[model samples]
Target: MARIGYARCSSEDQSLDVQIARLTEEECQPIRSEKMSGASRDGRTELAAILDFIREGDELVCLRADRLGRDTRDVLNIVHELDQRGAYLTVLDPHITTRGEAGRIVLTTLAMVAEMERRFIKERQKEGIAQAKAKGIYKGGTRRVDREKVLAMHRTGKGPAAIAKALGCSRMQVYRILDACEGAQTAA
Candidate 1:
């Protein structure tokens, strides 16, 4: 049975070095890493690949339970999936594993803590934003896409997919921009 590792960070700016180093120290092979939010399972292709590739009797390792997922349901679902495949999960930070009944209990408690931590983080962020706005210092999120360029390309018969590809943004962003432009035109 192989021992595989998975590492993740929420955004592109965050570093996966620490997790990778720890996993490597544990002699985990074929480590999978990704830059995506752990709040949900969506858009985590590396995680998906790991789930699909892990075989029976293999151990799936991560630096921490939160690295696997922050939502309790998502984390439980992932563990259930691995269980169904006869694979086990090992969280290194607190050294919890599914190999024992006590580990399962600790893992469940940690999952709930992680979920609560995520909610607390969001609440803190919202409060900070509100305070900043009240102080006239909140400018909100920066726009990565050029609105005029998107509109120009759309007027020239470019589709949302093509525009998104060229602009280095998601198709959903392209659609929102185009839809907003159409709404503005209708209002005019």
Candidate 2:
């Protein structure tokens, strides 16, 4: 059996050191971490990799239940996957493990709490945005990618991949900009 760790931080500005240290203290080797939101399973490539890497008799350790996931369905799916693979999950914060019945129950409860907390966070964020909008202070997220530049590159015979590489963006973004430009032209 192997002990593997997974650490996460919601945003790039956040640090994963604390969670990594805890997992290290637990003697968890080959730890994987990522900077991504746990609000959903989307874009969490490292977590997905860990899920695929774990084998039977392996242990997946994390610092907290929320570190695993903020959605109840996602958490349950992860646990079920581990169970089916004969692997166990160890959460250090509350010291819960899936190796026993009691631990399983506690883990489920903790996951539910985490999901609830996520919902509360979203609600609070929406309220904050609404308040800011009411005060004419909420402008929304800044657009980092220059859609006009992307379209210009495409119009100059640059392919989506080339435009994306030059602009430090994804090909999908380039395609979207080009598509939008085309749609605008057609509408005109």
- Which prediction has the highest TM-score against the true structure? 1
Error of 1 at 156 (Å): 14
lDDT digits (tens) for residues 1-188 of candidate 2: 89999998886458889999888888999999887678888767778888898999999999999999998889889999999899989999889999999998998899899999989998999999999999999999777579888877877998987987798655555676778888999999
C-alpha lDDT values of all predictions:
0.90, 0.87
Model 1 CA deviation exceeding 4 Å by range: 143-188
User: What local lDDT score does residue 95 receive in model 2, on the 0 to 100 scale?
Assistant: 92
Per-prediction count of colliding residue pairs?
0, 0
Q: Residue 77, candidate 2: how far off, in angstroms?
A: 1.0
Worst 10 residues of 1 by lDDT: 167-176
Q: Could you tell me how far off, in angstroms, the CA of residue 112 lies in candidate 1 after the best superposition? A: 0.6
Clashes of 1: 0
TM-score of 1: 0.79
Residue pairs of candidate 1 with colliding backbone atoms? none
